[model samples]
Target chain A: MEGRLARIGLRIWVGGVLLFLFVPIAIICFYAFNSSNIQSWPIQGLSVKWFSVAWHDPQVRAAFVLSLKAGVFATAIALLLGSAAAFGVHRFRFFGREAVSLLLVLPLALPGIITGIALNSAFSFAGIGLSLLTIVIGHATFCIVVVYNNVIARLRRVSGSVYEASADLGAHGFFTFRTVTLPMLSTALISGALLAFALSFDEVIVTTFTAGAQNTLPLWIFGAIRLGQQLPEVNVVVVAVLLLTVIPVIIAVRLTGGGGITRGSAAARSAMDSGSPGA
Target chain B: MTSTVAQGGRPGGEPASSRHAGGVPGGGSARLAAALWRRAWLRATLTLTPPLAWFLVIYLASLVVMLVTAFWSVNPFTNTLVHTWTLSNFRQLFTSTYLIIIGRTVGMAALVTVTDAVLAFPFAYYMARLASNRGRQLLFTAVLLPLWASYIARVYAWIVILQKGGTLSWSFQKLGLGAVNIGYTNTAMWLVFSYIWLPFMIVPVYAALERIPDSLLEASGDLGAHNWRTLRSVLLPLALPGVVAGSIFTFSLTLGDFITPLLVGGANSNFIGNVIYSNLGTAGNLPFAAALAVVPIVIMVFYLLGARLLGAFESL
Candidate 1:
């Protein structure tokens, strides 16, 4: 009887927490159809007018395109560099291997604002203009760790003997890698790239510093929210961005076999363990 | 078998023989592949150099440059960075106004961490232990879904809910509880920060709780401990590391966030991030911004070290 009562309490608490999490999201979705320009109590009325407004806004289109382009370029660069780093760290023991792993994790483990300011200062000092290219570079720096973590975690789970066996069977390194290793790593890479893209897509802080005059979708959203005149239109765009970001995340989770989004923290733990003496 | 033995005899033989056996045309590329296969160090170099060089040149070099910039001064009249070394930037950071901003930021970060932890523990406990497997998956997805949702939009949801005559006020009025507006206040910032970072706390705590063996919980019960005792003694201690791990995210995210304060906060709310942002963008004081940025870095380094000692990294 006591256990049953406790269980009831827990279920209620969990439900409440879930409501807290989702109510805001549902509100965002509902308000996308809100007709009024000003956000007031009870959302004056409902219509689809804001959707057309957001669609026709050229600045919104430009920002959306810029975000997509940056996410793709950043994710691509991250895949190449992250997988290579993972393979290197996994296959070989070397001097400063710990340092390398630490360096990769720092971009993520530290605050984004620090990463923003650091990159911003560096670009100015080096006379590199802040543009889409700089934004991609800034993003790729952090995105590499996401891919690195995913690939490295997958690498650890996969046995090295497969590669040795392939080599032993008269397969060259390239052939072995293509035939065996690539198949093993495909899901991890795909999920990693997706997550990286999701991250880069919605990133505002680092993009703020590296973008200079350019506006990514989130930066544009920030401006619109601040301006307050475009509340209804911002809601439409927010819902659209919500779809864009959440789809990739859900797909990535499914691709990773729905273990919950623990890869980021797990990779951080593994990286830390690899650096420690007894771990 | 002979090929295997010969390949064992010469490390490079496998690639050469494989090329020949496959009847593929040999070229300089094949020879280079053979050479790379023969030398582990060479392969390592080939794989490691690009990523490592990128980190060093772009990421680490920038951090070092930012650190150096923090030591320099900016000319107020011209709004240009004077390259000459000075300690004024750091010295100015010690003043009371800046100190209060730092304090407010740290205080909010701590408050948010605690709020999320308290809210997350019960939800996570239920998901980890009480829920059916199917229910657990659904709940897990629910927790994760918000994390990927646009953070700005989620925060904006609060503005609609908390602003004057917003949802909360409407609900209150319907209930005859009188009108209330907490919008654009620190209270609103607190609520939003707690709401925004809750999933980050949930994921790790759930991972930690799910990892605890059912046998251990059973053992506690078998040993004559009641449910509350088992939870207090066995569960909470094991879940501490996960709590600590989650706190790292909640803490650092709030510490460095200027957007929440900018969007949700009223006039009095100035976080360290806001100060750094204003100095960099509005004042054009890059050196001062870099100096201010160092505060979070130093605080986090210490916090991370403490968390490491507490085994939070393992939980992460």
Candidate 2:
């Protein structure tokens, strides 16, 4: 009886913690449809006016499209770079392989503020016009590291001899890759692509530096807040952005979740044993 | 190797081992040997160029440039940078106001790191050791799932909680207590930072706790050593790396994040990131801002190296 009571107490504590984590999100979702123009409580009449306003806003739409464009291009570029790097790292015994790997992953560790300032300074010094091109290029840099890690880890799982065997059977590089490598890596590739897309899409800190003059979705929101132009519309757009970012995020994470646990975890262990999990 | 393979191959492609017996030959070789080495190198370059260029130009070179500009002088009146190298940009960085902001940022990061670490340990432990397999997976996913959510949306979500009519106060009022005015407070900043960066803490701790072999815990119990001692002596040491990783994520992120403070930190609660943003944006002092930004990176380079050294020691 005492043990049962103790278990209930622990469970209650768990519930309270989860509630703390989730309640704010739930509140934001609730307030998006809020009839009141201001973000206030005590139930103003329910209206979807803000949502409509958000939907019709041209600036919001443009920012949305720009973010989408940025996300797609960034992910594609990162994938191309990351995939090749992964292949190179997996196969070649280069002298500075570990150094290269660290350099690739270092951006993730360096504060986004640092990356932003660096890119900002670099762009200005070079007199390069900051546009969607600069934004896409900026996003693709660190985003590459994430995709590279995912793909390389997955590649490690696929036997090296498998690729060798295909070559031995007189198969050309492209054909062998299409048949043998692509099939096994397809899942990982999809997950990595989705992850890259999400990272670029929701990214704010680095984007602020790279995005000069033009605003992506996140920057647009920040601008809206700074300008204090439209409150309810801002709330509605935030809700929309939430949905946009969350859906892909959930999908990417869930898809990779199982893989991260079983085969992925065992690899982490063995890598730890070797004292280098590539950080 | 290519010549050996070609010389070793038979017409029928049978007994491929014969390719090993074939030695390197002159330029005259089989039909399929169409400049393999050259092609491989070309393919490598072509495949590798885009990412390499992007990294070099955007990420790596940009940092080098920022470092250079941090030491340069800029004329605010003309909006032009002076060619003269100077330390005034850096000298002005340690002013009383900026130092307070830096201190606040580090203090908030520490608070968030500590709170999140404590909260994550039990949850991760239960999931790793106590929960059923499916249950554990679900909890772990729930933990990592937040990292995917929109950053702005997440920030806005917290405004609802910390604002005047937020649930914390509403509940307090419900319980016949006075409402808590958390808005624009440091508490609000810490709470939001902890929520946003909680996944960073969870993922690593979960990974480390999961790595704690089940048998080890059982073996401790078998020896009649209580759970506390076992956890202290075994689990803590083993999981320290993940804890360090989590700390880095929370600390570095909190220190660099102007976003959280902008959304919730109010006017009085400006951090170093916010200071840098202001100096660059509204203040229009790029050189001073660049100097402020460089400070954190210099701090982190040392911090990351220290973490690695400590990680090396912990592993040993």
Candidate 3:
């Protein structure tokens, strides 16, 4: 009975933790329909009027479009460059390979403030104006690691014999890659891209340093809160971004399960598995 | 024809298909591909060049430039960077005020890390050992889904909850516990920081706990160890790396985060990140900002090294 009671106590604790996690999200969603402009304990009433108000706001629309543009551009660049690095590191032994891996992971491992200030100062020194392009560049640096981890993890699982068989069957490298490798790596690539896009969309710190005379959604929300204006509209935009990011994350969770690509030594072990047939 | 194909022959005497194999327009790409395939070094170079150049040129070079800039002073009249190097920024940072700021930020981070560890351990342990596979999956989603919520939105929810006459106060009054307002204070910052980083703590600890072999626990039991002793000796030691790993996230994230503090913290809640941001953003004092940022960078370098020593990197 003591053991059973202990188990029950643990269950209640976990449930409370889950509630703590979601209560704020629930509040965000609830206030999206809040009729009152002011945020108070008891939401005055429920209404969908803020959704249309948020939609019609020109600043919100522009910020939304800008975020989408940056997210897409960054994810595209990350996919191309990240997968190539993953493939190179996976298939061949090279000098500074460990250094390359460390460099790739450094952006995520280090605090965003460091990355923000570093990029911001660099842009100023180089006389490059902060703009959409700068934002994309800053975001793509970290997004590369997301794609690299996913592709490298999937690459480790792919048997090297497949590549050899294609070569033996008189197919050239390009043809073999298109027919054999691309298909095998598609899911990992898609999930990586989704994750990269989601991350870029919600990013604020680096975006703050890298943008000039423009606002992404998060930056706009930051300004709105600081200026303390259009408070309910902030709720509407938050709810929309929340949904947009949550869907892709749910899909990615389904694709990779609990073992996210960047989890740890499991992914690193695959990356270091140089004795595979393909290698 | 078969005999002629098999026979050694001059170029003009070769089979038509064999001749076309090396000469067709399609074969041009094929030839290039074959050549690349033959040279592993060239292939590696081709694939590594783009990403390598990006990290080196954009990320690392920028970091070096930023660090170097910290040694230089600003031209007060024009707000331009002076090429001459000086230690004034560092000298200023060593003052008691800046030292206190650094100490406060570090202390807050430590508190948040400990709070998250205490909160996350039980949930992670239950999920790892007690829950069914389906329940674990659902629980995993439950934990991860909140990450998708806009961080600002979540922080704002705390503001709404912690504000005067907000949900907490209202509920307390209903329960005859009386009203309590903790809004816009360091206490609020701690709660929000703990909330924001809890998921990061949970995932690593969960991964660590799940990896503990059931046999070890059984071995302890067979030796007549009670539950508490087994937990202290076998479970805690094994999970230490995971706890350490989770702490790295909780600690460093709090150390560098200004957003949670900005939204939830009162007048005096400035972290190292906030100081750096204002110095650069409003004061236009790049050198000073860079100098302040160096504190966290140094702290984190040591933190990361310590974590690696604890075998946290494997669990990361």
Q: TM-scores, in order shown?
A: 0.91, 0.87, 0.91
Model 1 misses residue A93 by how many Å? 3.2
What DockQ do you compute for every candidate structure?
0.47, 0.41, 0.44
**Tens-digit per-residue lDDT, A105-216, candidate 1:** 7776677889999999999899888889999999999899888877887788677799889977877778888899999889889978988888899888788889988899
Model 1 spans with C-alpha error above 4 angstroms:
A95-98, A259-263, A267-279, B1-25
| Residue pair clashes in candidate 3 | none
Question: Residue A43 lDDT in model 1?
Answer: 78
Candidate 3 to native Cα RMSD, angstroms: 7.0
Q: What fraction of the genuine interface contacts, i.e. the true contacts, does candidate 3 reproduce?
A: 0.54
> Distance from true position, residue B252, model 2, in Å?
0.5
- Residue range B49-152, candidate 1, lDDT tens digits: 78987987889889999999999877778877789999999999999999999999999999999999999999988887777767876787787688767788
DockQ score for model 2: 0.41
**Candidate 2, residue A25: CA error in Å?**
1.5
Position A240, candidate 3: lDDT: 86
lDDT of 2 by residue, A144-250 (tens): 87677667767766777987798777655555767988888776677778777877888888899888777898898877776667867878888877777667656
**TM-score, cand. 3:** 0.91
Interface RMSD, per-candidate values to 1 decimal? 4.7, 5.3, 4.6
Q: Tell me the deviation in Å of residue A28 in model 2.
A: 1.1
lDDT of 3 by residue, B116-175 (tens): 999998898988789886787688677767754566767877877888867888888989
Model 1 interface root-mean-square deviation: 4.7
